[model samples]
Target: MPKGKRTRIVALTRTRKKGLDSKKKLMDDLRSCLEDYERVFVFSVRDMRNAKLKDMRTKWRTSRFFFGKNKVMAIALGRTAEEEQADGLHKLSKALRGQCGLMFTNSAKDDVVDFFGKYVEADYARAGAVATDDVALEEGPLPDFPHSVEPYLRLKLGLKTTLNRGVVTLLKPHIVCRKGERMTPEQTRLLKLMNHPMAEFRVNLVAVWSKDGVVERLNPDADGEEDEEEEGSGAEDDAEDMDSD
Candidate 1:
């Protein structure tokens, strides 16, 4: 009898995890920075924005920024004097307990300090953010908005609106948001439509580590020391996307 063609069965293999490899690479890179850079800085961000951070990174092209899990970063710097790769690094690592990152630079300390101290970017506020100022719309013709948006403004934003002669008009004064009050999603949407920006993104230097075995505490009130094994306290590279405007 003639033999029929045989079917081939291929075994599926699971992909190997790269988490450990990534962490090892990060540790190696950090150690290399310790050898290359003159100083290492621990900094925290307020209202972190990736765009602004990338811009800042461009401005400081000579420096290196490392954002990773706090525990992993701490391990890279060493959590104890005996294990530390450099003098005073363990102390500096102690300040990396929260949402923060490291900056390794050869720039003058004063220059780096001045640049970060003066760097502030204004951005739009997001929902759940506190209103920076009162925003109210007076009862009148909203010629800025198209008549097509009147229904959205009335139904979605809960605003009193009407269409008058092909123009969107407010039937009654509407308080979009109050100062010091948490903003609602609708309020944030209205603010964006109105082109209002209220959030400010800034970086705060927490501590500095010098090659001469000196550790300077800049922001003592920052996050306190946390156990290296503490859960749910990883240092995130970026802020929550929901908070982004």
Candidate 2:
């Protein structure tokens, strides 16, 4: 081999090693986040138009979403492609390949999943879909509904479903995520306290707690009112006069 070619090969090897080291460091960081945080939200977004991007910048006044390379992320996650497929983290890997991003937080895992599911449904609904399957959903952000349901429903709904204020209504309020739009200051501030330990959810009047508490809703048939009459204190004539008036 030529000396020049040999030198170039050696340089490339060193660069590759450095890259691997950096990726390992990133993986460790993510793993640490996993330990510290209770949940993570993954997003898939198409490339924004220039005008839309500028509008998002002004509207959100927040950091732009980051699109990390899939290969680097695989390394950062310390998972081989085969292993990811085996373990089911591969979907996250696949999403990273497209126009995608992720949001990480230490909030409740159920809350995070709920948030992502609602976020996607909100966007899909904005495109004009009539109803979302969120009512029946339980665990994962991704669901396996009947094949006839999903993209078909979304396509029928179409684009222009967005509200004037840009808040996509979900089945629940806590799970809302407004893309390319600024959340009101109130919303941002409220999110911080939303994942609180004592926080509860009520369907009708029953309260459901985050940790492990439950309150049952009142059943009308279960509770009957007393029909017993009290002894009258006022004169019947006076009562008749009052009613007459």
C-alpha root-mean-square deviation, each candidate: 6.6, 28.2
* Deviating ranges (above 4 Å) for candidate 1: 1-18, 224-245
Best by TM-score: 1
For candidate 2, what is the lDDT?
Answer: 0.32
1-245 per-residue lDDT for model 2 (tens digits): 55664454345445322345544554555555544443333443322232332333343232222224445554444354465412334434433333333334545545544543343111112222222221221222222233333343234422112222333322322332334444433333323222211112111111111212121222213211222131121212221222221
* Overall lDDT per candidate, in order of appearance: 0.81, 0.32
TM-score of 2: 0.28
Q: List TM-score per model, in order.
A: 0.82, 0.28
Distance (Å) between predicted and true CA of 89, model 2?
3.3
The most accurate candidate by lDDT is 1
Least well predicted 10-residue stretch by lDDT in candidate 2: 200-209
